[model samples]
Target: MNTQEYMSRFKRFYWITLTALLVAASIRPGFADEALSRRDRQTGFLVVAEDRGFIGNEEIIDEFQLFAKTRNASLIFVTDERTGKYLRNSLDRLLKKGAERIVVIPLFISAAAPRYELVHQLLEREKLDVPVSYTRPYGESYFAVEDLADKFRTIPQPADTNLIVVGYGAVDSDSERKMQADWKRIAEKAAAGFGFASINILIGHDKKKKDDDAVARTEKLTRELADAVNGDGDGGRKTVVIPFHLGPKLDSMMSFDARLQQLLPPGTKFLADGGSEVRADANSATINLATWLQREANQSQPLAREDVGVVILSHGSDFNWNETMREAVQPLMKQYKIEFVFSMADQPTIERALRKLEQRGAKAAVIVRVFAMESSFRKPVERMIGLDIEGVAQDTADVHAGYGHSHGHGAAPSVPAPRIRTSLPIQTVGGLGASPLFAAALLERARTLSKNPARDTVILIAHGSGSDHQNELWTQALEDMAEQMRKSGGKEFHAIRVATWREDWPDKRAPWVDKIRAMVEDAKTEGGKAIVIPARTTGQGPEDKFLSGLEYDLGSGFAPHPMFVQWVDEQVRVGLARFADIRRTGMTTVEAKSHSPYPEKWLWW
Candidate 1:
């Protein structure tokens, strides 16, 4: 071989070796898995807090870090004080790292804060393709109320001690007004937990000129604090002041507190001010977020082997609606292992959920029907769960058929026994029928839309069952609700009527449409407004579709309301009590000829 030929051969071998190494690297297990993992990881979180200074900002960042660690999610922190450009830059970094779904949580005290609007506007300008969700600010949650109450309990005081909280007022007039309203609510909730003689909030800065009028406003607030402490007729009451700030150690907050203390009356005392707006030790916002993320993560896990398993049964359709149901039941997740089973339109049917629960070693199970009434839906559920009817009249003529029965027909069809039986005892409970909590939720929905009850005609609308008998039962229940409301001041309305989506047989829903339109027109002719209330499990349902283009106001359905949760909790308690009774009496099963399960009428309510 000549020198030129040897050099050419060496170059060819070098190229061939390089190509082989590249192919090996591409096929390596760990390297391929890492790339796949990066592609698959879609969820991330962005936490934004108004950064006044280091102490407050660091606390928030630390809390967010804890949340991110627990959720195994990527997190980015930004301050509202920075320009929108800066926030966009930070968010861009997260997106580049392969986060397709981002949840933005604002650390502000109120959901109405202007910072949220700014963040939203920035997202629009960037026009990011990934889906993003924004959580309402920290103060809106029931957990926040409880956290505030717990903080108030930590303040050592006499029974007659008055409480005063001071906060940094917003510069904008509208924001300032909203902040005042929100703070007043927080104060009321906190005071309710303790026997405070009185509670009030004083702003440390002026809304018109945030920085320029700070000193003058602090002086004014100090004087107001003095009056608040001494103006009450009961002269012996002492006043305690707390810096209601996200970062109390900030220079401005420290100066304001010092001035207020100097001007306070002799009997007034100031609480030790060190923590942020939310107590670091108490239910911090980050801690709450961590818990929420954990619960969400648990939704995909195999059912835990536990003492009790709760199956939240709902008539699920849209995936979004199922998500809403999941969120609504979050508070209960901490106490019991939970699995959701949809009656329709979703995976993991009731049969599947029960089998999973049994496999997970659940000693007993509870079926909490997330519905507004016991109607056609309940029958199938009973049959699926192996519950047997007991102690009802067997004769076709004598059986207690639900309300509007047109009898003298032939013998009733026989209901097959439950298809699946489990060793674990199961107790199925009725939906939110005729419960006081349900009535209260309905009233709240009505009052929210009513401009003037005395001038507005209110209509209670529900999704009635396919059976005429079941429709009659629903109508009677709504009538009973209307009567209760009428006795409790709902009579102030011009009139109240009960209407159902399924009024009769196949054409039942057709009549209600015209009836609703006429009712609205009649109310308009009489110089009154009309309000329609959706008496169902959730607000996002047929009411909007049926009442489209109508001039009347429509109210929301019952789920996600605190009262709805209360109703669910009450049912759980009742189911457990019944289960205990059954065990004590050694009654494994009840037998009746009727197709409907459960001997007791209340259980079928």
Candidate 2:
């Protein structure tokens, strides 16, 4: 009853314990090399990055993986330019690996609605023989916009100040026509939140392709819009231009907000809506992006520190936004060991971020951007990082351009940086262009237009002009939207398919009216839709209204990223809140990446 029975019981308990350990090891990562290996072979998610191939996708994939890891989800990534074979192979691979529930999210923005039809067709065909679900691109996600708004809400507020949202506004085609129309609506609704007597919205335009010339155009546009806001007798109004761009380097280059000070109507007051290139506010867009991702992952525990980090990339700015960006990302610095670096603009860019992480101590890094599309951004980011992050680069940008040719990310030329070698692992996540949160922000912005009780033809515009080889492609792709709107049920709209005077519209020809008439006719013939959109990224100007105003019921407007506006507002508030946080927080938050010591290495200097 003592020794013999006790020995027998011990033997049975030991066997039971061993069995439990084996089962636990099978379900947990790092338990056995074979365990993770087995899961990789079985439950990996299949990602098809149908992009123009930008480096940003690599970072998005890395972040998505990290997010999955935090939630103990495993995935296998497949990156490829969009093609039928690629999609078929990817689906086949996932199906063969026993994928039970697959969610296919296209990285392109314009493809959002069209891709749904494609997915439906494929699913009907039963080509993959698996349950595959397709999400409406990245930026379409509501959380994307909400997170951006939340981040903006965190910025400090100014006392008794008026804010004007500014961004690249000019449209050759119509990718963001709906978004522009939507943002105007959002602006009108914000009065209840901001408590301003009346808030005005403006978009900046690039009169030409050259950066300096574009700057001039932005200045002129700002002055004109300012006049529309508060100026009396054409002197123009005094207002703050809040940039709504994703990357500081690029934003500062063409964004009206950055050039507003230089472009202000002579003698009119213009204040920095937020911080500089190295301030937390500068990187608020990325912060909002990450917040959206964390939610997407739906983690049970807090997000893994490895899952988030500062991804400093430029859209190739001539004036570096690195220092200002560093400052903007400071809030996360103390918590995350810098993990990644690269630029959409400059060279010594993302490469430096990765090397910096290796120099410090990081197993891997996640890369992301606050932008909305992923055409050119993917290749550069991938070249800087690599395809090892589950090989499934994710991004917020929308991927498919309805008829092909998409708008790729851009920046100034890159400058090379030092490299480091370490055993620590690294991976890349891509752009956050179409993240659901960003889409929600667009919707919020759309609400702003609803405030116009007069029921005018809301024309949303952007400032777009570029000398780069890609500009023409973007212009053609962007400006032709009457057909798309007609397809979507919009009619009687007066939209101008023009680039900035700086980019391509300098001729000032009267034939442009013929173009306007063509679009109206197309809209009527196709869908009986009537509203016209100038869908530029910047602001509205005489040039923007050029031929359209003479037509029927044309009203001009701009669609700056609503969250960006909110972020600027928040930055102002944060700077003013508890002066201690302001002073102690440091004037700039940029941290030197271990791989690159120069502040401007990742941006144009």
Candidate 3:
């Protein structure tokens, strides 16, 4: 369809979808109106994210602002999760204004899901009812699920079509069943209509069993599928595989895909070019998500090309999966007439990406995080990438001159300095965590989960970090994003929680072993409702053993969490989006700031 036609259709669908949502929502005994009505007083909020040993998940303040703007609610207290402290001292002012609720909303997605849960827990313990609900996932009305599905349908059909649906499987009670059920339905439905004679579904596994579990399981399954295909060629059968995830190149799934391919017989045919691969640093994954969301929001109308600049920010890594991620995103970057695109970590930090746009003479840039929630990774990114160019420039100049480099270095410079480019207006977009866009993509995932309702509770375990602040950032993002499942879906307040490894043990504590023990206690008390999502950048290496340990640790606290959990899936998606953003910008530049000599009070580590 033409652009105009697409927009018209989208508008109709948007309203219809919203109407369906409200209709569906009406039945849910909406929040107590009287309780809501009691919130009549007005109060301004004093928000602050603690700068911990590493970057904390503070970016959500920006997201919360947008979300709050939509709801027209006032924010009262903003504090850092690390310190559990607020930056601004506006408590008395708010009380004087007759503010009834002192809502302490955490910007981190998973660290605190429905603010209300934490608020409820605190209220019950303290005997109060200010009622603070962790803001749930941004509902799907504005996100792009149906649109993403349409994109999936657009996969080119090959004559020998065989399909495989791959994804980061759930480890907990609720999610694993959901994933299996989702895949079965999608595969069955797709196979029936698409004329595929054979279909295979494999959930990437990374538990603490044997050394070769992933390789063995994938090889065994693929071989089974190949064996099913009748090589007689009487126009009788065909086979195809489609990854259920947004990217196919991710290490965990890719490792399995590679092993499976190697095991396939010579005569077996596979579809390599058409299927989606969810790899870290793949721009296509985020683009696919972005395009899908636009379609759902009725914002897909081809905006003036100059008006849109897509910037993807993610927790980048130095791994083979990072390369796979880059490969997957190249096509989308070339296809779209994006004003400017860039990624963080792979050569161009967000600062450098903005510099490219500034050089291009663009008016504005749309910055999006491929990640799932607001965490340390993204929190520092906001300060690093989202400030006004003017402010960055000032900061750069102050750093340069303060370092006593004010002397003219125009000629042969004695010392080289980092370059900072100024001249771009940036707009920070919310990360994919429960954003409407991802909700659409995940709906497919959820639908599958629902079919397998036998699973207990869903636990998403990410490669949380205690090692460094950077690691905590990524984990926090996943934790935050997991909250969406509770906000918009059918699950209850008690059904879902995003768990991380590092948080299980604070700094100065034991490593994976202790973290596992903590989660074990949490799981037992919570009715064994835990599903795991490995949080490494891509599913690879010993991380899986650590990620899978969470389950084993449940009863015996002897096992450690798997390194490769679903959190990694989310991180890879975030990385890919950022990679695409960096690709569009040829090069990046960041001016080095000058710092005063260490104060006498400062001690060396």
User: Which model is ahead, 2 or 3, in terms of lDDT?
Assistant: 2
Q: In angstroms, how far off is 48's CA in candidate 2?
A: 8.2
Question: Tens-digit lDDT track for model 1 on 505-577?
Answer: 4466787678777887787787888888878787544766777777888887777888877777777777677
lDDT of 2 by residue, 69-96 (tens): 4222322222111234444555565555
Better-scoring candidate (lDDT), 1 or 2: 1
Error of 2 at 457 (Å): 67
The better-scoring model by TM-score among 2 and 3 is 2
Q: Lowest-scoring 10 consecutive residues by lDDT in candidate 1?
A: 390-399
Sorted by lDDT (best first), the order is 1, 2, 3
What global local distance difference test value does model 3 have? 0.35
Worst 10 residues of 3 by lDDT: 48-57
TM-score of model 1 relative to the true fold? 0.43
Candidate 2 residue spans exceeding 4 A from truth: 1-62, 68-97, 105-131, 136-142, 150-159, 167-173, 184-192, 197-238, 245-282, 288-291, 297-605
| Per-residue lDDT of model 3, residues 302-351, tens digit only | 13344344555444446545554444344445422232223332224555
